[model samples]
Target: MPSKSPTPGLKRRRSGIYWCATHQAVQAGFRPSVARLPYSLENPDHRPLIEANCQRLQAEMLQFLANGGREQPRRYDGTIQSLSGLYQIDAASPFRRLKHNSRLKDTYVLKLIEAAFGKRALSALRIADFYRWYDEIKKPKRPGGPERVRRAWGVIKKLRELFAYGVMAELPECERLYTILRHARFAQPARRRMVMRLAHVEAFIPQALAMGRLSLALGTALQFETALRQKDVIGEWEPIPAGAKRGADDFVLNGRRWVRGLTWADLPADLVIRKATTKTGAFAAHDLKLCPLVLDLLERIPSEKRTGPLIIDEVAGRPYAESAYGREWRIVARAAGIPNQVWNMDARAGAITEAEDAGADLDHIRSAAAHSQAATTQRYSRGAVGKSRRVAEMRLAYRGLRNGP
Candidate 1:
């Protein structure tokens, strides 16, 4: 038999939402699930917060059973830590809407904020305090390394969101912090200059195929030719929802599912991929028929092997985990005599660069890459001299035409 909960009227779910069972009965004896408390059960400090919420729910249930009205608003203490906890747990907060990897990075910064000034009064914080904090966190250059500000910038960005959440919730301190920090300036990291060219892809594919890693070669061609993000090409691992039925295409690892990648089903007889991107939820359509590289690689795979994920680890016979995918790609890249500085991620950038260099329309590049803005696509079009050379030629020709030379 399974053990009973020591805490009544509350159950902790595998996904970490604190499920509250305390609720008043409605018509037909149906009781709705009231809340999913965001407090961490593992954090010893959150125990009191958990108990308080549970007690509040039970009290509300009793009051509803007696008189049948709405539950009262829960009051939050105005501390940085308290606000941080609320921001994390609030369903309507932007924090909840972030992609999984982004959520993890943002949470790390939030934890740092909580540890540093968690107990401090939010209203007491000023511009000077943030300036000092930023300076303290930023790393100065050592003998061999450049100065680091990216981490500091990330912290400030997350902190701003935290303050914004508080303001949205109508907290006074957050309003003050938001108002004061409007004028503060922070340094941003330099843009990346490195990009993998089609030459690199051409070299990598043959080397990867020579080493019997057909999946790596195929994914490389897809990213370079189609401008698909690495995640969109290989998919991601996510915890399986409880009681979820497994599908034929589903790749299971322990209790998790490998989802949202280029399944064989995505490619029909038309050879055009039409699917919503995982990050932006925007539709990106790429015609594989236009990509001779992808076509040639596809022909190399045996017919039976083309049934599941387009990029599969042959040894595991499953989709590659993000880290494993990088590791294997690095091994093949090294064997191909690719530089250590060149990354598999650069394939998308390389594609954008190639398009820009070829004088393709900016809007067309943005559409193909599934970018919402041309500015975003512009960022990926890195270090191309072809566009500049074309511009120079056009200017000289115009001068010649004007001067009758």
Candidate 2:
């Protein structure tokens, strides 16, 4: 079903350790250990180094195999040798180039593993050691907070996967650290909502505008009105040229006005967002579709002398970060007398509710939201209708009567 990797070999020279085809073949599992010389006797110091390098190499090789290394040539032998030296496991091997995508994530995991178990051979690490490291990291601190601890746990989990592969490949002992931790997991309490009235939405928009936070105000209002994600607004916005031909920059509002719209249209339609992007690379136009109200809001935004971003910081005219925008939202909400129930995601929920109340079909709402799954659309539609107290009461009554109450 698949082609096999060529064998790996190593060469021992006075200058440094070099790979030979014979050793390569043995390392790749194609040849027996008898094919390579017994380093245990001739180079006593080299034996420990070689063994340690072998463990690390085995881990990297397994990962390479799992990833279906068809995209890149198999170069695990050189990479393992280099990483071993870099981490101070062995310094005799030449440095190797790391695959660009794997380099960042791998480096982060390796560093964390090393810090937790300093100078310990990769083979010597136990499940308990990993647990100890995780426990130490989870300790509450004044500056770092729970978020930092979560990041550490995530890195540890990824590293564990890498190491576990080596263990499975017979290079090292398998440690069930993550499984042990899972059994001790505690359930986090759900957050309670403090509901506020919808009229607060109207008040917030004006205040944000008064304070020169038009983008924040309009963005938040638009989200509530259209059920668009925050990234849909801030990340994606094309400026409507003062006077230009219709293109990606133009949008139709109220069946009359031609305006620009904020949308993720620039991104590849199939692009999956694994992380946040900065203002310079923030919005992709391809992932967004603008509603009429969103188009109207964009038309109202002053395009004259607008340079940095369509959505800018109220105080500084710089592009707004999600966190900064979130903070501004709180301030605007408080100013609008909605000190409670002003959540970031509530806009999306509210829009769904509004559409459902207007008797829009599930398919229509799903298309508007750009949801891929019909189940997700069903969930939103069900939640939107069931959220009303009157509807809930009616449903309960209907169910009771149907059950012969």
The whole-model C-alpha lDDT of candidate 1 against the native structure comes to 0.78
Candidate 1 global TM-score: 0.78
For each candidate in the order shown, give its overall lDDT on alpha carbons: 0.78, 0.48
Clash list (residue pairs), candidate 1 = none
Candidate 2 has an lDDT of 0.48
- Count clashing residue pairs in model 1: 0
TM-score of each: 0.78, 0.46
lDDT of 1 by residue, 1-405 (tens): 111433446775544544354333443132233344556788886665566556544554555455555433334687887787777657678887776567656665776677667788886777988888887777765556656688777778778888888889888789778777666798877878889998899999999999999999999999999999998999987655545799976777644589888989899999999988988989999999999999999998788877878899888888996478899999999999999989999999999999989888889999999999999999998987667888999999999999994
lDDT string, candidate 2, 146-253, tens digits: 534665576566544544443443333334433444453432323333322246667777777787777777677666665566665565222223344665533332
Best by lDDT: 1
Root-mean-square deviation of every model: 7.0, 16.6
Report the Cα lDDT for residue 86, model 2: 39
